[model samples]
Target: MSMIEFKLNGKPVAFDGNPLKRLLDVIRDDFGITGTKEGCGEGECGACSVLKDGKLVTSCIIPVGAVGGCEIITIEGLRDTPQGKCLVESFAEGGAVQCGFCIPGMVMAAEALLMNNPHPTEADIRLAISGNICRCTGYDLIVESILLASKKGEGLW
Candidate 1:
């Protein structure tokens, strides 16, 4: 066991356990943050997506040790932010919240994209969320939602 320190949701935190433990497990079990869900533990699915140092990554594929000194932002951390609110409100207003299993990952992916490209094209939005899989919604609404957020949430991202 090792003590790994990192910034989680804008706060500095530490974990003392198996270094090889997945960040998803640490976030959900150790830190009790259940917003980030595990879909395909193999990392093929983006349901466990989180922001690692402001980049979108699958928490399930990342080891706890790898995140030391990095900033990790999960859905719980984002849902309250202005940008997050914009994305979420866009998702809701655009009817992209079907089934809602992959919304968190989708939102995270959108945030990661918007932070870098406040004015992204459809192709950009598609590519940004390509890692995520949403069985419901067909991605049209999600794409439109992101586009809407980009336009409506100007100066926020």
Candidate 2:
């Protein structure tokens, strides 16, 4: 066992456990950040997505040790930020959320995209969130939501 150190939601944290432990489990069970859900154990589903050093990744398949010295941002951490507020509000206003199970991951994907590319085209938005699968609104609403957020939440990204 080793003490894996990383920044979580802008805060430094250490996890002393098996290095192979899933980051998703650590975030949810150890760190108590349940906003990052687990739709599938595999990485195909984006429900367990989080921002690792500004890149979107599937936490469920990521080893906690892999994030050592990196910054991991979960939905809970982003919820209070301006970017998060913008995306959430945009998703809501654009009817992006339905069952809400995948909304958190979708928002994380959007955040990652917006932070990297503030003015993303529809194709860019679609590519950014390609890993995420939403059974609720298909994907038009979500795409529209991201586009709207890019316009409405300008300068925040």
Candidate 3:
């Protein structure tokens, strides 16, 4: 076991555990942050997506040791921010969410995209969420929701 330290959400966290442990497990099992789900452990599905140093990554395939000194943001963390709230509201308003399993990852992806480009085009929205697979709601509503959020741009930086 090794001591791993990193910033989670907005707080500094340190813990001693197997350095090779999957980040998804550490976030959910150890930290009790279940917002990051495990859909495909191989990183194909974006359900376990999170922001590592402001970049979207699959937590399932990333070892805890690799994230030391990096800033990680899970869906729970995103929900607390204004941009996250806007995405949530826009997703709901545009009926982009269904079954709810994929929304968290989708939201994180959208958040990352908007943070980088607040006024993304339709193609950009599609490209941004391309990694996230939503079996419930089709891509149309999701894209529309992102467009709506882009128009709002209240919380996005």
Best by lDDT: 1
| Error in Å for residue 41 of model 3 | 0.5
* Local distance difference test, each candidate: 0.95, 0.94, 0.91
Encode model 1's per-residue lDDT on 1-157: one tens digit a residue. 9999999999999999999999999999999999899999988779999999999999998999999999999999999999998899999999999888899999999999999999999999999999999998889999999999999999997
Model 2: runs farther than 4 Å from truth? none
- Regarding lDDT, does 2 or 3 come out ahead? 2
Candidate 1 yields a Cα-based lDDT of 0.95
| TM-scores, one per candidate | 0.98, 0.97, 0.97
| lDDT (Cα, 0-100) at 64 in candidate 3 | 97
After superposition of all CA atoms, the RMSD between model 2 and the true structure is: 0.8
Q: Which stretches of candidate 1 lie over 4 Å from their true place?
A: none
In model 3, how large is the Cα lDDT of residue 87?
A: 86
Q: Quick one: best TM-score, which candidate? A: 1
